[model samples]
Target: MATYDWLFSTLGLEQWCGASGGSAPTSLSDLAAQSRGETGEQAVDIWELPFPSMDALNDACPAFPQSRELTLGLEEGFLDIKDTLSVVLDPITQPLSWALDAALYGILNTPWWIVIPLLLAITWAVSRSWGLLAFVAACILGLAFIDHYDYAMQTLAIIFVCAFICVLFGVPIGIGMSRSDTMQNATIPILDMLQTLPPFVYLIPLIFLFSVTEPKLYGIAIILYAIVPVIRLTNLGIRMVDKNVIEAADAFGMTDRQKLFGVQIPLALPNIMAGVNQTIMMSLAMVVIASLVSAPGLGVLVLRGIRNLELGVGLVAGLGIVLLAVILDRVTKASLARINATHKA
Candidate 1:
């Protein structure tokens, strides 16, 4: 006799139990074992903890649902809305795919010699530091020597696109937030959630929203994961701009737009730069994770290494990522330093 049979009989639930369509179990102690495909005849030890499975409850009464049913219901619910979400989201996000594809194509097809020299020149122009220029050159050259140059470039191309979009849209949002307390209140919670969420979680909704073959599948994930820092810092920077400076601009008959452009943004440049720096780093980090959804670059190599148990492959790809990160960090920081110096002077 099942342990719950007496209770069911006492409660006039025999009819309900008959309708449940579950097999009889000797006792609640057997629920976990039954769920695991084990025999349910074993006795429960007094010292052991008991976990009554939802299936066990269902066996006792038809009204009770099994755990699997709940999970299945959730899956069915998401599936019901999945098509609607894709229809609404696909057109709006298609351009992101185009930009990412273009970047990957341009970077991959360009010869190393042309790409390397152009990068060095851009670095030199931005930082005005020959030492930094050389370091950046060395890092890229090192990746090329290892035959990891293409992989590195793929990673960089994604970062270049995602980070640019992040700043383009994120800065305006930050500016809006900085100008209004209500907006700030509404935005802070979202930023907090995005910043704190696990990197992999960013991919889950995107995976369902877009096909895995699409570039925007991972592109969306990388952007969502990396964009938070720039927005938060941009807001902080603008709000931190000195009130006296703002008043000074006002006294000179500067309009709100002029004050923002001439006074506020200029003073806030350093913080904004810092945010860009962080956003770039975060982009790099997510690119690796995004590889799971078909993101190209060193991350693909890294993921391959992990999947195939190739220690050397993983290590080399990881080193390539490190080199890329250093090159990016140094370049951005040097640029930031130049901005700070110009402001101080």
Candidate 2:
């Protein structure tokens, strides 16, 4: 007999408990029965330990019996509302899809020669460090030589788009948070939830909300996962600006906007850039996981390797990701250094 069968029978829940045919099978007996192909009826496992009677518990708590019903109702409610949500969200989010597609297409279609030189030029302009420039050049060449350039570029395109959007939106939000205590209080918990939620969990609701083919599915996930650092850092940077500097700006007859742009933003540039660096790194980390939702990149190859159990493919793609991470990290840090130098001057 199942461990809880007697309790259920005593409580008049035998009908609900599936114990009528005989004494209900214990969990182990049920499994063994199934394995032996003797499954006329399956046994249900009920929580009975430390409880005197099922009826007592049920009478004491009607909610426990209704929990499954409540869950089903919630699921139905979400399904009913999902279409309404899509109607509202699609138009607003279309631009993200366009931006991501354009970036991916531009990178993939452009000649390697043109693309490589353009990247090198940008690296030189930002860092002005020949050593760093050479390292970036070498890394790109190596990725290309290994035929991982396309995958690398796809990953780069996604990171570039997502990270830019993060900075573009995150900075303003951070500035607002810095200016208003209420806004900060309102936003911090949301940011904390996003940062602490499991990375894979970000995709679950998104998968239901958008088709696998839509770039925005992964785009939204990437932004949500990576945006926290930039927002926090930007807020911290602006708030940390010296009061004396603000007073000087006011004394010089600077307007609020002027003080913010000329005095505060420049001073806050280091922290903002640091946030950008972290955002980029986080975006890179999500690339592989994002591939599950049709995000193309080295992540796709990594996924391929895992699914196929090909060690060489996974390891090589992983190495490509590491290389990309290093290149991005060095370039952003170098730019931050330049900003600090100018701020000091």
Q: Model 2 — which ten-residue stretch has the worst lDDT?
A: 55-64
lDDT for each residue of candidate 2 in 38-145, tens digit (9 for 90 to 100): 753455446534354443334333322534566778778878888898888888988999999999999999999999999999999999999999999999999999
- Winning candidate number (TM-score): 1
What TM-score should be assigned to candidate 2?
0.84
Tens digits of per-residue lDDT, candidate 1, 1-345, equal 233444677888778667433465545655776888875345645665334577656555656677989989987887899999899899988999999999999998988889989999989988999899888888898889889989999999999999999999899999999999999999999989998999888787777778999999998888888898899999999999988988889999999999989999999999999999999999998989999999999999999999999999999999989988998999999999999998872
| Highest-lDDT candidate | 2
Please give the lDDT score for candidate 1: 0.87
Number of clashes found in candidate 2:
0
Deviating ranges (above 4 Å) for candidate 2: 1-71
lDDT of 1 at 85: 84
- How far residue 159's Cα lies from its native spot in candidate 2, in Å, is 0.6
Which pairs of residues collide in model 1? Answer: none
Runs in model 1 deviating more than 4 A are 1-62, 65-71
C-alpha TM-score for every candidate: 0.85, 0.84
